[model samples]
Target: MDRTAHGLTSLRNGVKTLPLAPMRDNSEIRTLIDRVLPVVDEWREHLTVSIGRATELTGLKDTQIRYFEELYRQDRDPAASSGVTRSYSLTDLRRLAVFAELLKEGYRPAQAAEIVRSFADAIDYGAAYTVADALRREGDAITDGFLLSRLASQVIFAAQREIGERLPDARIIAMFLVERRIDGVSAEEFVDIARDIATHPQNVLVAVDRAAVIGNESDSSESVWSDDESSIVLFYSRDPWSVPVPDRAQFCYYRPPSTPDATVVFMVESAGYRSIPPELTVKTSARDHLLDWMVRMCLSIFPEFRQATRAHNYRYRSDGYRLAHTRQSLTRLMHRVRDLIFGDDADVSVACLLLPDDLYKPMYLSILAHAGYPEARARQARLMLYGEGEGLSGRAFNAREPFLTLDAEQDLRVFGAQDERCKVALAAPLLSHWDTHPFGVLYLASQRPASPLWSETAFVALVFGNILSELLGRWWLTRLRRKHDNLLHRYVAEYIRWFNGMDMHGPEFNEGLQQIERIWERIAVTSASSGNVRTVVERLSRQYVTLVVLDIDRSRQLHSRGDEPFLLAAQRHVHQAIAQILPDVRGYWFKNDHTLLVLDGYAPEEAIVLIRRIAGRVQMVPVVIEGRTERTTVTISAALKSLSYQELYDLSHHDREVLRSSLMTIIDTIYEQTRGCERTIKVFQHGVWEKV
Candidate 1:
């Protein structure tokens, strides 16, 4: 039997299987049949086309038609027996017909499906068996097939409107159907076609979705070849429109068990669809586009630096290296700016003022040559805050304003020979946001008399100057921090080294400690007013000093093979812990095994308890060593000593060994008495110390 006959038999069997409610009279049944017969007849006339006929009419292969057929059938009856064949309706055929046409017009399968669905939803077929009847009822038909064509036109127009609204540059091009395993066309050929289309300046975008062949190793038996395998839709568009297209297309596909290769139904532009005007698409202006590109380029070169809070009192001394790096960054930026505003042919020179020590005294940064002038001549240019200088740069710096001169030789006096060679000169002060005075002045000069300096040129110069000002400010702040850190480190080093050579019996012992104390006090008053340094210094000076020596118990267990980083990290962890727990504590690394913490202002008993607490906290936390986390256990011994001038003066005459022995005896006795006691703390009072 023919496929249609088989479908009819299935429909009959399906109807017979339906459960019927008990009816009171035959009239009710007749009334129901009268009402439903027209709709059923309509479906038969439009939707009852065999799968073979569907391929012939819609230009979709058999497999492609089956894909859509299965999608609709499954959607309508998800739990129906899987092996049974289902019938396709006119609704499904109409949607497929529209989708095929859209694919030919260069719409992706998914996009075409969306358009077809929207068209189907928008049309009202009330009581009409055919599209022609529907059009007649709406009074839209002018002649034979005219209404159908017009309806197609309306659907296409709506689809175009949707595409145009969402994607401005994309328009219908062309689409058609193909076989997944055609004789001459291979996957590589399809890829090449896509590449060729993409290369076109106007063809900005391209997309292709292929059907997976049934017999292919990649295909699984469990795969439902419904919306997944029918159509391969491709879309292409011009430049900006060529950006990645949105994935909104919805096309159906099905792979029959008997078919080897999946049917690839596609769409491309043809003569039927109306042409879209090129003017309707958005086109960015060249100037705006260029400016955008320039901004992106600038940002890539100089990313904005985010300043983190200062966590440690240490700074790197790399001023020379930092200055060189800053110069390189500024030079590249200057060249970019010059190329942007003044063309390469123009005799442009750019230089920045250094302002080494004070802002008022400006020196040459010497990054770029001064406007086709020798580097030495540029270096010679300098400015004073109040002095009357011959150079235009000096005048600009004094006035704190941009200075522009048409005749450099006549208007300027400093750098006499060099000024005579330049016809145009422009100087703009590099003003910083964070500072009251300008950091430096940016100078630009052109030797060519033909190149006129416009007002816009001056504006560009000012802008470049401001950018340099901000960058310079960051560099200056970094320099100041390093200088401050170096000074602090120097004083601390001097104090520590000075103690090693001191004799307790000498008169200078008391005087030397007092002098170091005074220096620390001056630093606290002058520089570190309220930060970590100030807190540390105040604590050290105000209270009796307690020395707590912490020795890592299992230091020998640390990995010996390239374990430097692990050891350093462990040390940092300990230091950070102590600093967090006791903000006023000052400590130093002694040898490689231990750290000596100087806790100030605490009595002997209080000092011992504080040290015990610090040790406990450190031991409880785990540290990562050799890629493994291990608890840090340490043995601690502490001794408290007073640094009073009178006590030190009396002890100055005592033997050095006796003084050291007395202090050691006190610490050893305390450790012995309270080795593991939690509540009781061993504190060496003056009486206990004297007895020792």
Candidate 2:
């Protein structure tokens, strides 16, 4: 009876705040009917809800409403209006929203009313035509789209059978005795309780079965029906209830689902007891009321307990489901809010805005595909974000990334965008906290135009869209970092391969260098250009790498920094870090103090990480030195041709630096990258690269 018990004041206030419509004439109705019918026809099946809601919320007067009523009239008795109240369901609210849409679009009350009437007529025709067409094709069998028809029919029949069996018992014995003129007031009251229990007779049967099972039908054995020894004696009796005296002895219960497997007992005595009155009396009636209360308590509390148990199980076995459930819950709440205010016909879409134009092209062309956005459309949207003049079409205006209806009339002016065909749009601002210029934007769009139902669906989607955009941005950031790290690895591997010819401890060094080289090659091939995959590799290699083996004053101390896997991988870090750190040393193009370059061709501006790491480790303070050396590889090639390690090791420290720098330069040179004006660089002294 009270379908709208909550939010009455809020709904009333919202309606009061809305602008009123102007007067309407015949011409306005004709124009609206024509414009609306086409869109409605195009979306006959999917757009039914929008069409219906638009008709309802349009604020038509009684006379205007009568115009529509003539088309779908049913035989009604004059007496039907007596003491009846008209209550609108959610469906009715949707119809009202649709009417509001028509009115808000400049159609006057009368005109909008007439247009809705015509629209309803068209809808009726479309449904009838489709149904007839379908019937004409199929033979004898009907092809209705009701999925659960048979199951529902069977359930209804079974319910009717059970109700049929119980009705006679109540009518003959219970009703006759209670309704008898000689029966006292107490007897009449007992009949009322029986009627309430009979309202849902199946539930009564279940309560009876549960109470009997818990009592074990007079069995006192602790084992009862259980095979396991993990049993405990527990009381399962009717909780307190407002039952009269005669039936007070009929309370019963069994083991509740919330507690562990156990035997039932009396609540007051805390011992095994099942009270079943010998004859139908007032004591039995009172006890039955108490028993029903217990049943209700068990039913209500068991779900919460079961949910908690399942949640605990999911935490250990399926963490993904647990996280997904949280997301879904949030989404569901958003949808409910949307449904309450926006009407059920509203739809949602997303728009993404980006700062600085350069990142757009690469991001749209590359990253959009990964996120399941159409690449061509992404590129077009990218162009819109970068291009000047009234921005992309279908982009939202109020909030940069707010969910908005794309009814075209509402959104076109807001976004300041053009050349896009989206009806609804939502935009997410891709503002980077660290970068002065944002990376780029991620947006979502829907082709379907807005209707009232869109309120709930769009609200859910908006929340989901914002979440998705954040995730995408984070993913992009992580991806960019990984790409840079991988590039650093490539430069290190190449440097190692080049240095292998200079000094070979045994076959192990050769194999290790070969393996490293292969890995670097793969990284180079797989890495994306946006991540600075190539440039990072070359810069670190050039700055930090000098000789294959440095003349260290204290190798023992450096090695004793604990056996953390990260520290142990310093050998590899020494190789990769040099490739990352070198570019910032002003005019230190050819060499630095820790990284020496003799007569060997080294990579340019790379090899910074390794040099910084080893140099930082040795100097323990800043060591500022710059020098250049001749190409070492030219000489090493000749020594390697003769298979002589002694001749290779004879190479100077400057020569090793040149080789390291040259290897680092190889990766950076493959791609040209301009560093951002506000770039931040970090260097780790004790092999930070290895842990990653």
Candidate 3:
């Protein structure tokens, strides 16, 4: 169904392109699927078509085709000057089909032939077949026209629903029926003409002249309606299909999604987003072929339309379906990769992704998903397969590249500890554009090492890994967007109600503004344009704080001893240590070297003992740094301060400032004092320091 979505990547966005809006059932209209499919399949076939073949192509006899071709010099077949039994080419066939469509629309042979000649270049064979398909599907319904009331409601509702009335100005709409431009007609006139010409089914397109209305064009090589003569133009066969250069990256043609083979497209120019009574916009239906054509037109010719749809992709639809859609998409790709890499032995092979626990401090990957492994083995692997620098998965993850081992048991990278049945293995790091380095590892192991070519490995590493990362990243972004939206509604909605035409400069109003800003600051994941979450509210109240900061001492020294990964592992080790030492205290990660623990109602004496205990525990953690296991020391800097309402405005920054001035050097000295000279660190009432 050509669900590529003009490259929107529906895989991540989760809006399944709906079925091609079908035409209403019509018994009298002969079915043309067989004929249409053949013409569509041979759309580009350059071979000459015989007079007999041409008759079949257009459902017209030789006499009518000859009369039309001879009468219209513009759509006449190329000059061959062949014998008496004259032949026709594919172009001749398209012209004849178009002419036949026109004739069926109650146009006399002369008028129909004239159109085929005048707009010879404007008509496409794709349009002819599309018109045929529409005719056999819609019957005489379109000729019936729509009531002004229903049409008005559909237009108004769909526009505000899809675009939320964001576009400026009232857009004017026009329709091109065959070669006639039905421009700027009244509501009654529009409906009357629509039904008057509805005798034959036509392939329609809603063309929007973006340049006429839209401002601030985006940086995209999208196709513009070079032939735009109105604000919003509709084209059809019995119709005119706009010329689109599909081979070029920039072109206006948009093929029907229902019939992918129909290359002819009608374009809609979203002319600065106009207004009319509005055109009915229910593009969803088996019988909604006309409105569906409108949708395809805009998406194809206008980048702004595509942008609008992409921007609103998940609002309500994504929140409900994105997770399952993303998971299914990812899983299908994994299974395909497995089949590509393993073939007949795929059932006995294993391919799994290992998402690491933490990026730094303790670097290790766990099996996030797997195939071929029994449930028990998959669980076991999930728990302990890739530990520290233990397996091929770890090797790939740590190296941030692809790793391959022809023999797993004999390879030292496998660590001789797991996946006993696997004889060969391969792993590649999955890279994320959002992250600084690899986000996860794609691991593959087999019961027997099948000889796979380098191309296969490269395919898995490059294509599979990239697609996985894209889907995962998009899914994550969707989730984050949903969270951010919810936060805005929940935290800012109440504050907005107090903002009527109240005093412009009153203290109460200013205070209300401050309160709203503070609420946003505290709750927003994305703040003002910055995407840093400083304080996450676990409990909300006018609670007091005992802010304690812990730092990994001389963290750079670990980098000199081991790779950067080892340095990260060292940080993780320290974080885990601090977490265990003060299990009851809530600590926030503040970079590789520090953890900020905020305690409520803890006395100065309690803060002193807690920091010392954290420092001691962190110093004793056996951190794996640069391939070596060693104990690393940490520096404890602290504060025992209470916050008034105003002080909590920039909570994290305020806490850090207090920690910076808390005499960290003296605190360190006390934690490291010799046995007999041990001293205590304390904060007195009213937030003062005391050394005891």
| lDDT, each prediction | 0.42, 0.31, 0.45
lDDT tens readout by residue for model 2, 1-692:
01122211112313432233443454454444433333333232333233234344445554443333332232234665965533333333333434556757765444444345545543233223356544442321112111112211222222222222333221111100011122233534634544443232210111111122233222222121122111111111111122121332222122322332321211111122432221222123222343334434434443222222221211111101111222235345434433443453324332233322233232121122212234455344333433232333223221233344456445544342334445654443444443333343334444445433245545554555456556545544433433333333323333333344233222333343333243344333434333674564554333322222222222223332221222223333332333444333211111110112221222212334333354454333222211111111100000000101222222322344553344444322211111111111222224231111
Tell me the deviation in Å of residue 481 in model 3: 2.6
Q: How high is each candidate's TM-score? A: 0.27, 0.21, 0.32
* Candidates 2 and 3, the one with greater lDDT: 3
TM-score of 2: 0.21
Instruction: Give the Å shift of residue 488 in candidate 1.
Output: 1.2
Quote model 3's TM-score: 0.32
Compose the digit string of candidate 3's lDDT tens values, residues 1-692: 13232221112124453333222232221222222323433444647767887777678888887677656644333565546456666666666766776567565665555545545554443223356645643332222121211232222223322333334433322222123334455656754454333323233323223232233232221111111112222222322233321221111122334545433212123444343332333333322443345344433432222222221211101121133233345556667777888888787776677665533343555554556656565544532334345677676665566777776777777733354577777777777743345667787777766646245676657677887776555544544444433333232322232222123233332333343334435533333345333433322233334545444555545453443244345445655666686676444433334444555555556666767776666555566543234544444343343343223444444353443333233223322332122222344355444543
RMSD of 2: 33.5
Best by lDDT: 3
Clashes of 3: 24
TM-score-better candidate, 1 vs 3: 3
